[model samples]
Target chain A: MATITYREAVVRALAEEMDRDSDVIFFGEDVGKAGGVFKVTPGLYERFGPARVRDTPISENAIVGAGVGAAVTGLRPVIELMFADFAAVTLDQIVNQAAKMRYMSGGQIKVPLTIRAAQGGGAGFASQHSQCCETWFMHAPGLKVVVPSNPADVLGLLKSAIRDDNPVVFLEHKVQYTEKGEVPDHTEHVVPLGVANIVRRGDAVTIVATQRMIGVAQQAADELSGEGITCEIIDPRTLVPLDMATIIRSVQKTGHLVTVEEAVHAGGWGSEVATRVTDEAIWSLEGPVVRVTLGAGIIPFSEPLEHHLIPHKARVIAAVKRTLAV
Target chain B: MSEPLSAAMRQQMLQRMIEIREIEGRIQELFLENVIRGTTHLCDGQEAVSVGMAAVVDAAHGDTVTCTYRGHGHALALGLTMRSMVAEMMGKVSGCCKGKGGSMHLTDMPNGLIGTFAVVGAGLPVTNGAALTAQTKGTGALALGIFGDGTPNIGAWHEAVNLAAVWKLPSIFLCENNLYGEYSPYADTAPVENVADRACAYGIPGVIVDGQDAEAVYAAVKTAADRARAGDGPTLIEAKTYRYRGHSRTDPAAYRPEGELDAWLQRDPINILAARMIADGQITQAAVDGLKAQAATDAQAAIDWALAQPHPPLDAVHEDIWV
Candidate 1:
């Protein structure tokens, strides 16, 4: 096993994919020369050259539309929008064009494109720059929403995303980029989409989290462990091809459920998960499915206020504890 | 392009234009008969722009064209059979898009009708990506964006054009300036007099052509295609066309001024192309009339075949969502 940071893992995955397939090309604003806005992609241009590794203009529509066009024609383009919030700029391109091209074309065209963008609020860039817009893609039918929490998951899942024959919205929390973890020294380590990871196996309440929330859920689980509360942490790596089986199995085993996410509470991914659990495994539920999510209103510029809005360890712990009270 | 247009090719172009016109007229009749569900934007008067530009597009070379909701003509020009297209409009399983993509979203990937987007300016950026593939892989193939005057004022238009220019990709931007963006007229919506003028901002050559003249369009697109295939850059060609039909389903377009339609009809695309061919002695009036009769016959046969096709299966809707 080798130790690496999440950012390094992403870079390594991209390099390995590009090395494996000449069809895989990467581009975004400042992604080539400047690596990326969050420095997730560095040294790609030097290895791949300008044609494959391009730095595109500040046009999200074009960036995403190009990915769609290239994928349908030939190339497997993995483009980037500096922030997940920029998805709003090209929602029609992503939600309408890229997502539906394959389906709308009656299986004539396949958009094997992967869109990588940093999401979740911790950067203090306020509402415009720092928002976890996972729901937008998860709600989209054709898109595969993959958000990895650790370095190894980042490396493995990204490689799979590039190889998959569908459009994938890979959300990388900028906060996880610097976080270091032990990565398996596998030559072609690929974590397939639609599989949830059982991070912590415990009989207490099952806490389902992803991206930065996985770490926060871990912290809560650790703190709750001292009080004899064993929490089973399930990271739903992908949202669209959601592994409801894993979550339901965990719910059946533990008889309790709580979801923690970085998005706002209403119409969130958590809400969907909660409804599915209720629909599928209501008898197994010991209490109501508690959703620890971001507060209402736009995320503020103030760090303290933003901190309050984000679902931290305390909120998750309270949510997990609330399931026990029932 | 070295030699003048052959008599056979000119005859074929006129035939295809007539075929498109017949299909469009058939669709309007079907809509009125309540056989077609939802709205359809017909390209009744803009056939020359599609057929002429399509004359230079070698679909076998991996060339693809993306167009707007008014795409029945574009799809036909790009080689989608009338059967598949009409079936799609009628929501049949044997459609070009298997009934999922109706009149607005006809797609035939093999023949290079990439997609017909309902949203304005959506195809331009996606088409650029196809050009990007050609550039990256050194494929001589190109992509074309067939949009209306409405797209220029939209956000994706600027984003798509600027990026194409910067990359110098092999893409053709064909603007069918039909003097209207949905309900709004060009004078009321766009500031510029000509849609081609928008291309100057991107530092690309924007040429304006008589949309009613097929030869003018064919010549303009040929030059642009040569430049694109040679790895020079993209070109914006605006075809000053008119749509005889309204924007969408069941509108008479009363907004047009008195005699505007009449003036446009005086320079009807089919009439213009037929007149040129007659003047050059390539085609006779009797031949043109015969071609028109054949087009109507073909449209009827296509519609009959489409009507016989079954509706998409219930489970089929869930299929193709992933692959």
Candidate 2:
């Protein structure tokens, strides 16, 4: 095992995969020579050279559309959108082209493309750069959405996302990049899509979270353990092909659920999780399914307001208590 | 007919053009009969540009073309069989995309027709992407995009063209100046007189040709394709053309000037090519009539075959979302 920051794990995944397959190509604005604005892709251009790792102009449509075109033309392209919010500018390319091309071609074409973007609301970069837009991709049919919370999950899941046949949107939480964790030493390590990871096993209440919310729920579970109230935390690694079987089984055991996410409460992914669990395992629930979200609003620019909008351990603890009260 | 097209090349281009016209005519009949529901975009008068492109490129070497939603002509010109074309419009499981892609989204990559985008100027960047593949592999293949005169006003066109120029990808953007973009005339949408003039901003050569003359379009495309193959980067070519029909099946095109359609018809691509061939003694009037008859027969036969095929399975909607 090796201890590394979440940011380094992303760079390692790119290097390892590009080395494994010659078809894997990475390109984005300031990715090469600039090492990306977030400083995640420093040595890639020097190692893979300019042809494989390129620096493109500020053209989001070209970045994604060309990636789809290249993918169908026989290249596994890994494109970067810089910010998750920037996906709005290239919605037609991401939703209409990449998601529909394979199905539109009736299996004649396959878009083995991975789009990686940084998301979340911790650094107080304001509205344009700090929104959780994973729900938009989750709304698309042919896309696979991955939101990993740790270094090991980032490395393993990112490798699987790049190798996946369909278009995968890997949204890396900005706050978690500096966090440290132990990753497996095996170079071949990869976490498959559609599998939920149980961060902590318990029998009291099931807390289903995504991205940064996993860490929040974990802290709350640790504090609740002292009061003899243990909770099971499930991080749904991928949202589209969600591991509902694990979630349903856990809900059956715990008899309760509290879905958490940093995104707006309106049409958020938490509602999707809550809807599925209530429909499939209504008898297993002893209480009403609860959702903990950032109520329909924007991510503020101030640090204090941003933290206020983001769900903290106290909020998760309160949500757990609320679910038990029901 | 012209100095560039040899006897065999002229014959091939004429046959493909006639096939496109007849297939589009049949599509109209089927739409009226409620045999093919929804909407259909026809490319009757703009056949020369699409068919002219097929006369120059070698699809066997991975050369591909991306065209707009009015793409029946492009599908036929790029070597997609009339049976597949008819089957696709009929929504049969035996179609090119297994009835998944209708008339507006014809896609058959093996035959080099990569895609027919329903949205305007949506495929230009895709062409650059395909060109990027050609350049990286050192293959002398070209990726051509066929859009309309008004596409230059969109963000996608500028972004795609700029990226192609900066990367020097082997790409070509062909603007089939069909006089209008949907309901709006090009004059209303674009500030420029010719779409090719916009290419100057990208530091590439811009050429304009008669869209009604097959040989003229062929020569212009050959020049651009050669330049791309030689690593000179992308070129923009505006083919002056007009569509005989409205944008889709819904409108009667009452917006056109009273004599505009008649004037454009006087220089029909089929008649222009046929008249030139006859004057040059390359093809006789009787031979032209015979070719026309054979094209009609082939189109009718394809329609019959397409009618016999079954609709896609009910559960097919869930398939093809993944590999």
Candidate 3:
């Protein structure tokens, strides 16, 4: 095992994949000589050279559109968008072109493309930048959405994403890039796309969270454990092809659920989880499913206000309590 | 100017143009008879641009082409079988895309026709990527992008051209300046008279050709393709063409001015090519008439074959949603 930060884990996974497959190429704004905006691709440009690791112009649509084209032509392109919010600029390319090409083309083509972007609110980048929009992609068919919480998951899941035959939207929380964890040293260690991880096993209530919210859920579980309220934390590593079996199994044991995320409450990934649990495991629930998320409003620029909008450990604990009361 | 094409090649080009016209005519009849559903963007008068460009690109050598919604001509030019294309338009299981990609989304990957995008200008960046693949893999291939005048105004067009130039990728951007973006005329939409003029901003060679003249288009694309294959970078070629039919099956195209349609109709690509062939003694009028009859028969056979095929199975709808 090797101790590494989330950013280092990303670079390791990309480097390993590129080493393994000659068809694999990486590109984005500043991803070449500058090594990416967050330095997630530190030495890739020098290692792979300009042919494979390229620096692209500030064109989100072209970045994703070209990736789709390259993927169709048998090249595995991993494109970086710098920020998930810019997905709006290239929505037609991502949601329409990249996501629908295989299905629309009657399976004549396989878009083995991975679009990586930094998402979520903790960095205080504000309204335009600080948003977890995985739900937008989760709602889109033909797309696999993944958001990893730790360095280990990042390494394993990223490798699987690059090898998968479909297009994957890999969301990395900007706040968690510096978070460190133990990652396996083996190159063959790969986490499949649809599996969920049970971080804490308890019987009181089930708390499902993703990305930065996973840490908050873990912290909340620890605090609740001191109060004699045991909580189970489930990190649904992938949103699409969701590991509903795990979440349902946990809810069956706990008899309550609280879903947390960094996106706004309405039409959020949490809402989908809450509905799925209530739809399939209502008989096993002892109380109504509670969702811990930012209220319906844009992320503000003020540091305190931004902090309030993002779901923290306190809000998760409050949601766990509310679920217990129900 | 003397024609750069041989007699046999000229006859072949004329035959291909006739085939496209006949196929589109059959589609129109089918639509009227309620046999085909959904809207179609027919390339009635833009056959020269598609056939001329396709004549030069060697698909077997890894050359690829991407086109916009009005892409049936390009599809046929790029060697997509008539049966598969017609089956797709009819939503049959035997379609090239297995009925999933209807008329506007025809794709024949094995023949190097990457895809026909429904969105305007969506093919530009994709073609750029295909060129990048050819360059990186040392495939000695090039990618061609066929779009309308409206596409050059989009941001992707600019980005794609700039990227291709910077990378010195083997790509050719062919703009079919049909003088209209749906209902809006080119003059009303773009500030520049010629779309090729915009290519100067990217430091690439830009050429304008008579869209109705197949020989002219063939020569221009040949030069550009040669430059690309030699690693001389990308080129932008604007074929000043016209679309005889409406933007879609439903449009009346009443927005066109008086005599504009008449003036363009006089310079029809099929007629121009036929006249040249006869004047040059390459092919007699009787031979040209025989070719036209053959094309009509072939188009009818495709339509009949597609009609005989069954719809895709219910479970097939769920299939192909992934790899």
Candidate 4:
């Protein structure tokens, strides 16, 4: 195993996938010579050349729409949308075209495409660029939503997404780019979609989170350990074919649930988890599903307001306390 | 200014236009008679654009075409099985989309017909995407995007064209400028010399054709398709046509002027092509009549097959949501 940052893992995974399959390629704005704004695709252009690693026009619709077309024609294209918020510019292609192609075509066509976008707002990106739009993709059926909290999960899930014969929306929280973790050295570490991992096992409240929120939950869990609140954290690596079974069973055992999401509290990813838990495991719940989410509204440009808008570790801890209080 | 078309291709083109007109006429009758359920956007007068542009498309592997709501003629002309298309309109199990998609949503993937969108300008991005894919994969395929005049103003249209030009994608933007967008007239909707003129803004050649002249459109599209396949980049061709029918089944067309429909009918693409074929002495009247008869029989057979097909099972609604 080697210690690597989430960003490094993503680059490695994309490079390895391109090497493994000639059909696999990466394209997006500044993804070629510049190696992406965050350098997530660093050194790839030189290694793969322009055909496999391309820099596209500053059009989100073209970036994703091109990816969809390429995928349907037998190329596995992984496109970067720079930021998650820009996905709205091409939601029709993503939701209407890519998400519906398989079903609309009666399974005659497959969109073997993956969209990687930098999400979350801890870096003080304003509302237009900083919003965590995970729920938008999760709400969309036929799309596999994957949000890995660590380098290992990111590498594994991306590799799997590239090979899958379906469209996947891989939301990489920008804040997690620098976060380091131990990733397996194996070049073929594949993590299947629709599977969740139990990061920490505890009998107390079950902390269901994804991507950056998983790290925050882990940090909160460590602090809560001294207070005798053993929090069980579950990282739902993939959100669409959600690993609800694992989460439901965990909630049943713990009898308490606290869902964490970086997006706005209103109609966020946490809401889906909360609703599912209520419908499936309501009788097993010791109390209402406590939701630790960002305040409903835009992410402010000001650093302090941005920090205030997103849910912090303290908020996560408080929610865990509230859920376990009964 | 240029010669219209060769006698043989002209007659064939006119037959296609008539086929679309007759099929749409039959569809309207069936819709009112309750034989066909759901809404429809007819292409009665706009037959020339579909037939004219389709005359130039390659339609081979990798080559794709995406149409807008008024897409029946486009689908049929691209060789989509009339039976499956009619079945889809009837919401039957054997429909092109397995009955999930109705008239507005038609998909024929096996024919390299990517799909069409109900939303007016939605197909622009889709076709542009296909062109982008073709360019990246080095397939030498061309994507023909058929949209109405109103779509050029939409954001998707601009984004699609701009991206295509920047990437030098092998795409042809076929704007079927039928002079109206639903209830509103073109003057009220768009303010430009021509929709194709906007293509110059994207650094691509733009041309306008007499939409009522199928040969004129075919010529322009053929040249554009050649340039695209040769890696010269995208082209925008505005086919100036008119719609004889209302925008939808519910529209009575009160927005049209006196004799406007009659004036357009006089310049019908099919009749004009038929006349040219006779004047050029390439084929006898008997041949034109025979093609029309064949098209009618084919259309009737489609209707019969659609009527005999079973309705899609309610369970199948959730099936296409994923591959």
- Report per-prediction Cα RMSD to one decimal: 1.3, 1.1, 1.1, 1.9
- Each candidate's DockQ score against the native complex? 0.89, 0.85, 0.79, 0.60
User: After superposing candidate 1, which stretches have Cα over 4 Å from the reference?
Assistant: B1-4
DockQ of 4: 0.60
Candidate 4 deviant stretches above 4 angstroms: B1-8
TM-score of candidate 3 relative to the true fold: 0.98
Candidate 2, A136-181: lDDT as tens digits: 9988899999999899999999999999999999999998889999
Clashing pairs in 1: none
Q: Score chain A of each prediction against the true chain A by TM-score and list the results.
A: 0.98, 0.98, 0.98, 0.97
Lowest lDDT 10-mer window, candidate 4 chain A?
A291-300
Model 3 CA RMSD to the hidden true structure, in angstroms: 1.1
Model 4, residue B71: displacement in angstroms?
A: 0.6
Winner of 2 and 3 under DockQ: 2
**Residues B152-173, candidate 3, lDDT per residue (tens digit)?**
8898888889989998989999
- Candidate 1 lDDT tens digits, A1-326: 99999999999999999999999999999999999878888999999999999999999999999999999998999999889998999999999998888888888989999999998787788989888898998878999999999999999999999999999999999888889998888759999999999999999898999999998999999999999999999999988789999999999999999999898889988898899999999999988789998857688999999988898999998998888892
Residue-level lDDT tens digits of model 1 in B210-312: 8988888999999999999999899999999999978998788999999999999999999987998899988899999999999999999999999999999
lDDT of 2 by residue, B169-219 (tens): 999999999999999999898888899889899999999999999999999
In DockQ, how does model 2 score against the reference complex?
Answer: 0.85
Instruction: Tell me the lDDT of model 4 at A152.
Output: 93
TM-score of each: 0.98, 0.99, 0.98, 0.96
